[model samples]
Target: AQSVTQLDSQVPVFEEAPVELRCNYSSSVSVYLFWYVQYPNQGLQLLLKYLSGSTLVKGINGFEAEFNKSQTSFHLRKPSVHISDTAEYFCAVSDWGGGGADGLTFGKGTHLIIQP
Candidate 1:
């Protein structure tokens, strides 16, 4: 079975500062990587993904992450964050089994607190 683990449950940062949310996964087969952001009482939006090609992947809202295969880690980073960046961030992965399954498994989620 595949699973994801978020290193931190919460990250606090001041407005205009930077932040990083750590994520790790365990899978026996190859898979796709994705990051999602969810605002209060809202559904998740795709932040970024690591499909094929470059390990460095960029996402919306000035967010980016690197796919490290050896470490089995994908850490999200934002150089400068804003107050509006406050939300819940999730690290997810999808399989390529073509089993037509839901193809999505997410971490518990990390609360991003952006201080004004």
Candidate 2:
């Protein structure tokens, strides 16, 4: 079974300040990773993903994350943040295709708080 751990439950940052959300996963077998952001009254949106190839993956809204196999970490970072960026971020890991029969594993999620 695979598991994800979000280092921080909440991250508070001023509007326009850079922020990073730490995510670490534990799995015995190979896996695909994903990062998703969910805003208030909205569904989860794909932020970035690491399937194969490059270790660093870029996504929409200037968000990016690097896949570190040795460290088993996929940290999400944004150079500059906005008030609209405040939301819940989730990290996921799946061993087989689309979670397989075991289902996908997910973290508790990290809530980003943007302050003015």
Candidate 3:
């Protein structure tokens, strides 16, 4: 079984500033990690993912996350953020055996509040 934990419930950052959202996970077997963003009144969108190969994976909207196996962490980071970036971010994990059938387990989510 795999589970994701988002350390922060909310993150407040000024527009154009850098930010990092902490995420940790625990699993008995290897699993794929992902980050998804949900804007107000919208569905969740895939931000980035770490399945294999490179430890550092980049995704849409200038966002990236590093897969640290030793620490069991996949933290999201952005160099600069825009007001449009403000949304609810969720960290998710799924095992390869599931193959999209079981779906992913997600964290509680972190509200990214971009302040002026």
Candidate 4:
């Protein structure tokens, strides 16, 4: 079964500090990589995706991630985080070839705490 795992359940950091949310996946077939962010009662927004080509992918809100094929990992990183960055981040994966689950399989979730 194709699955994604986030290493951290929560990451606390002071305002303007750097942070990283680790994500790993195991899939027998091709897949799409994604990072989604949810703020409070709001819905999630697409941060970035790695469909094909390029190992390092940049995302919204000053965030980025690198896809490591050998390690089967895609870890999110932000050079500097702000208080507004406090939210829940989810790592997801979807079947690239279709016929599988159309929707994403999300990680448990990582609560990003940005303290001022």
Candidate 5:
């Protein structure tokens, strides 16, 4: 079984400031890590993912994350943020070897509040 934990429930940042959302996971077997973002009243959009081969992965909208096997972490970061970036961020994990029988387990979610 795999589980994801988001340390921060809310992150407040000024426009154009840098921000990072912390995430950690635990799994008995190898797993895939993902970050998803959801705007107000919208469905989740894939921000980034770490499936294999790379420790650092970049995604849409200037977002990036590093997979740290040692720390069991996949924290998401943005060099600079905009007001449009205000949304709920989620960290998720899914079994790497499963046949999609079990869906992804997601963290509670971090509300990204961008202050103008």
Candidate 6:
């Protein structure tokens, strides 16, 4: 099993302003890290992921994350945020891939509050 930690429980940002949500994971084996966004009354949406190759990974809605092996972190960041971006973001990790039945250790979500 893998372990992850989200540094903050809430992050308040103004619309059109930059924002970052911190996440850290502990892995003893090769692992994949993921970021997901959950909107009100909606399922989780994939934000980004770090599997291999380059440390920087980008995803839908202009979200991105940099995998730092040294820091053991994959913090999600967006250059600018919209009021619609307000949601709960989560960080998760799994060793040994495949979507279904594969266990992913998830960290507590960070609520992103987009303000006008």
My TM-score estimates for the predictions, one after another, are 0.96, 0.93, 0.95, 0.95, 0.96, 0.93
Pairs of residues clashing in candidate 2: none
Stronger candidate by lDDT (5 vs 6): 5
Q: After superposition, how far is residue 50 of candidate 5 from its true place, in Å?
A: 0.6
Off by over 4 Å in 2: none
In model 4, what is the error at residue 77, expressed in angstroms?
0.4
Candidate 1 Cα lDDT to native:
0.93
Candidate 4 on 4-116: residue-level lDDT in tens?
99999999999988999999999988889999999999999999999989999998989999999899999999999998999999999988757755688899989999999
- In order, what is each prediction's RMSD in angstroms? 1.0, 1.7, 1.3, 1.1, 1.0, 2.0
In model 3, where do residues sit more than 4 Å from their true spots? 98-101
- The CA lDDT of each predicted structure is 0.93, 0.92, 0.95, 0.92, 0.95, 0.91
lDDT of 5 by residue, 1-116 (tens): 77889999999999999999999999998988999999989999999999999799999999999999999999999999999999999999988767756588999999999999
Model 2 agreement with the true structure over 1-116: per-residue lDDT tens digits: 78999999999999989999999999988898999999989998888889899999999999999999999999999999999898999999888564456455889999999999
Worst 10-residue stretch by lDDT in candidate 6? 95-104
**On a 0 to 100 scale, what is the lDDT of residue 108 in model 3?**
98
Ranking by lDDT: 3, 5, 1, 4, 2, 6
Cα misplacement distance, residue 94 of candidate 1 (Å): 1.0
Candidate 5 total steric clashes: 0
Q: Please give the lDDT score at residue 43 for candidate 2.
A: 91
Give the true-structure RMSD of model 6: 2.0
Pick out the ten consecutive residues of candidate 5 with the lowest summed lDDT: 95-104
Instruction: Give model 1's TM-score versus the native structure.
Output: 0.96
Candidate 2 vs candidate 5: which has greater lDDT? 5
Candidate 1 pairs with clashing backbones:
none
Residue 104 lDDT in candidate 4: 86
The candidate that achieves the highest lDDT relative to the unseen native structure: 3
